[model samples]
Target: MAFGDASFLSRVRGFLIPIGLALLPCAIAPAFGAAALPEEVTVVAKGSGLFNIELETTVYRPEGPGPFPIVVINHGKAPGNPRFQGRYRPAIAARFFLARGYAVVVPMRQGFSKSSGSYIVGGCNVEGNGREQANDVVAALDWATAQPWADKSRILVVGQSHGGWTTLAFGTRGYPGVKGLVDFAGGLRQENCTSWQQGLISGAGNYGAQTTVPSLWFYGDNDSYWPTPTWKSMFEQYVAGGAKARMVAFGSFASDSHTMFGSPAGAPIWQPQVQAFLQEIGLPYEPQPAFAQYAADPAPVASGFAAIDETDRLPDASPAALEGYRVFLSHQNPRAFAFSAKGGWGSGWGRGDTRARALENCTKKAPEGACQLYAVDDEVVWAVKP
Candidate 1:
């Protein structure tokens, strides 16, 4: 079956592929180091507009036991009315840090998916709009640092869109363990507001004046939400107000510049800068040999299958799983095949220009006689062996 259509069976919007291999605890390093798989976790954090609320979070770290440096990933807000806010998954970004041996935390703050509370972004007046969300980030960080596996002394905060704005506000607090901040296409816009852009600049300036942490800001030339010029001005105001920061405007990326950290494809465009920033801030930037080797291997099994549902065949497309798929594709012949074994039978999928090429690749990737093609694109090529 084509992997694209198989995605429709997933309950979540992002990849649902399972990650194979057992991850070691933080204290005991694996003999053959492998990146820790991302785990969906829930943390109880005090909410601002609301009282106590549990934020939905994802954690990714190295498979070992010693405390690891932490990187909190703040998710961007979805477009449209504030009444309906969705969850943000940072699996791809988590891999980038996981490879470097850092614990990455992605939290769905209050009012967002799975997190309790109402979505409220102070209307058009736009003054201090992000402070409320910043509180969530701060609360999440507090909980993350208290975890036994996290290194509270070294923390990095990264966010996008509204989350980006939230990170900037967090920087102003000079939180003890925080080392740096990275903003990806931060800020909100309301065209109808009398002077929304100016209000954003003012907000940035206010935060910048008190921001003690070093920061990196990235924006795309084609960002629709925050135009290049407007964001540049915002950065100017931020820096002018005594914020220590560096800003980079990347070339056009994808359909919208705002999606810089939203997809796996966007990783390459921002990974280098992120790596450099980590090193600049004195955090781990290099990947261990064992983990790198693991990343280079092909993936033939689906991960994160539902424990209660035996027939849940949805594939996980998380960064680690997808990376394995990428490795397999890299070794394949022009029309190479990749097979996933499930339920004592083989389910195969491959990319090629024609049916013959696709089937050929599938068979070639499979053992000499073990693989039997069951589906090609939308067509079934073989009946059940039973």
Candidate 2:
């Protein structure tokens, strides 16, 4: 059979099984256990007409008492498949945060998972699958915040691929209490530019410009589906529009097989960065001890941008601070200039004064026009010459 035939067949099979099982509920075995059990709960969210839509959520709470920060994670496009939900469990990321203290909620959208309603994709209704999914998230947050164990003030929304697209949609609608967002390979447009198409509809308007919530967008440089240039351009537009946004590209692939975020190699690089991002925005969680150490000992800020003579100017003086500096430069939208840390008199002339000032004055040095200082978090600092 053709690919479209196969997909349609799969959907039909899934739809049939659920309907058949509903008629004979006992045929399905229970999978509930401490390991499998989430702080399970249900809520009826306001949907179209008099029919109240039922939303099923799995809540994972941290060890502490009182209210803890919350992160609402949404599943990707294959909402009806248990396998899909199983793959994107918030518990994986939740355990990391729960160790530091956070409550995670994974909700099933209408017609997907245990939630009531048919799965509508593409723009079928004003509140189709995408919007309904987003609404489920908002409602989950509402439910979580009201709980005695959740911290209403510090909430974050994280989604990957299709879920990432959902996150962007939900964010544009302006959900209250969301302070930060982590988007891993989230889709922004519906051109089938990427392979991981979830049949979800794109929201109206440019989401990049509308997103004001502080967010981090991650994609593998080699991501096969979405090209880096397109991703970067979208993010750049968002940033240009005064949105608090940051983009981090890993490897050099167009699509990192959609698993870079969860890969063993990728985890080490991204997990800490994500933790740092959360901490940077005051997410109310502790970083893992090892990751915390990494955060605490960011490579030292290099000094001596002004003392070197012109003849001795080295081509790469700011090697130690390159990464942090790059992040700073990208966010500030500074003019392009050659970067050199080598000591030299002429080295600081061509570069703008603002760049010089920002990287100067580390380790008790006076603020001079020779160098500029850029600080990252409270640990890492870098000096660049103008």
Best candidate according to lDDT: 1
* TM agreement with the true structure for every prediction: 0.67, 0.56
lDDT on C-alpha atoms for all candidate structures: 0.61, 0.50
The candidate that wins on TM-score is 1
Error of 2 at 323 (Å): 46
- Per-residue error for 202 in candidate 1, Å, reads 1.4
Listing every candidate in turn, what is its Cα RMSD in Å to the true structure after a full C-alpha superposition?
14.3, 19.2
> Which stretches of model 1 miss by more than 4 angstroms?
1-36, 47-50, 81-86, 125-127, 293-386
Q: Which segments of candidate 2 are over 4 A away from where they belong? A: 1-49, 79-88, 124-132, 188-205, 252-257, 288-386
Q: Quote the lDDT for 1 in model 1.
A: 14
Candidate 1 structure quality by residue, lDDT tens digits, 209-301:
887667889899988798777898899999888766778788787566776675434566788877877776667877655445223112112
Q: What is candidate 2's CA lDDT for residue 164?
A: 75
lDDT of 2 by residue, 49-151 (tens): 5766666665665444757778887766542453234323433354456556667776766666667666655453322444545666666666677777777
